[model samples]
Target: MKVILLERIGKHGHIGDEVSVKDGFARNFLLPTGRALRATEANRKRFERDKDDIEKRNQERREAAAGIASGLNGKTVVIIRQAGETGQLYGSVSSRDVADALIAEGFSVSRSQVDLANPIKNVGVHAVPLHLHAEVAVSINVNVARSEDEAARQAAGEDLTAINYDDEANEAFAAEQQAATADLDTSEE
Candidate 1:
């Protein structure tokens, strides 16, 4: 369907710009939300009449989004979750969880704004993208850990995810050390 956008809706189109979008999207979202109108002659004329006002509003919104992005970009959010010794979380951290964490830190964010391709299921630091506007997106650090101490270590640049302790490796290293010590003692005697 062809429509004239009243506002910026992601990558679809800018305010007062005529663009084609999915029929379902036009019927269900754009038309109902007053963000767009069908590209008929009358609606086009109406859009042209209100074009300046619509563009002004869109510019204001974009500027606000850019300001928010400037403060949020390069910031890290710590998330504590339960996990086994291997650092695999018992439950996953979804975008909603990240948004809530951000809100707790006094930032205005919504779950839909978090651009997580998939939920985080492991304990470590991850770079998550946040789309504040069509042209403004920022990557924020998400530190997932089992405890406060672990979270601190992760934030301090420690990678515990790759450290897997094996019982056999520990036993072999201990036996080798004992043998070397015994050999030294026997030679001294």
Candidate 2:
């Protein structure tokens, strides 16, 4: 059957697209779910009006996504995990982790938007691509670092503080402060 999509059925198709599908499938799924309508003259005209509105809304969304992409460009996100001596992670970093990192950084992004082919296994810097829109993709830096403090605490069998993996600069600064304090204590002898 020929139908005009009222909403996007999948990732690619837009609203008001004339697509061919089986009548039974359309009746059972698409029509009932309000994903499409029969391509009659009245519905076609209605679709024409709705198309403009949909396009305008999509444009606004694209613009907002672009702005977010701009803000995220060249920004580094850190994820600290337990690793072996060779830097192999105990567990890999998944899209959900990346999404959570982005969310913590004040960006509202979904896991589905992340385009990672496989979970990160080794610790280092990785370029992660985020698919904000169909044509809009932006690459963000992800640094997976070994949780040194966590590892030390675990080795000594002490209670480990929950390490914040979102900020690399803060962690670096904290290390520097600790070193400075240690130096002052040694010099005060």
CA lDDT of 185 in candidate 2?
Answer: 100
> How many clashing pairs does model 1 include?
0
Q: Pick the candidate with the highest lDDT.
A: 1
Estimate the overall C-alpha local distance difference test score of candidate 2: 0.80
**Candidates' C-alpha lDDT:** 0.91, 0.80
lDDT of 2 by residue, 74-135 (tens): 77787888877666789999999999999999997899899899999977677899988665
Regions of candidate 1 where Cα sits further than 4 Å from its true position: 166-175, 180-189
Off by over 4 Å in 2: 1-16, 19-43, 148-189
- Tell me the tens digit of each residue's lDDT in model 1 across 142-171: 999988999999999998887656878999
In candidate 2, which residue pairs clash?
none
Residue 85 deviation, candidate 2, in Å? 1.6
Worst 10 residues of 2 by lDDT: 153-162
For every model shown, the clashing-pair count is 0, 0
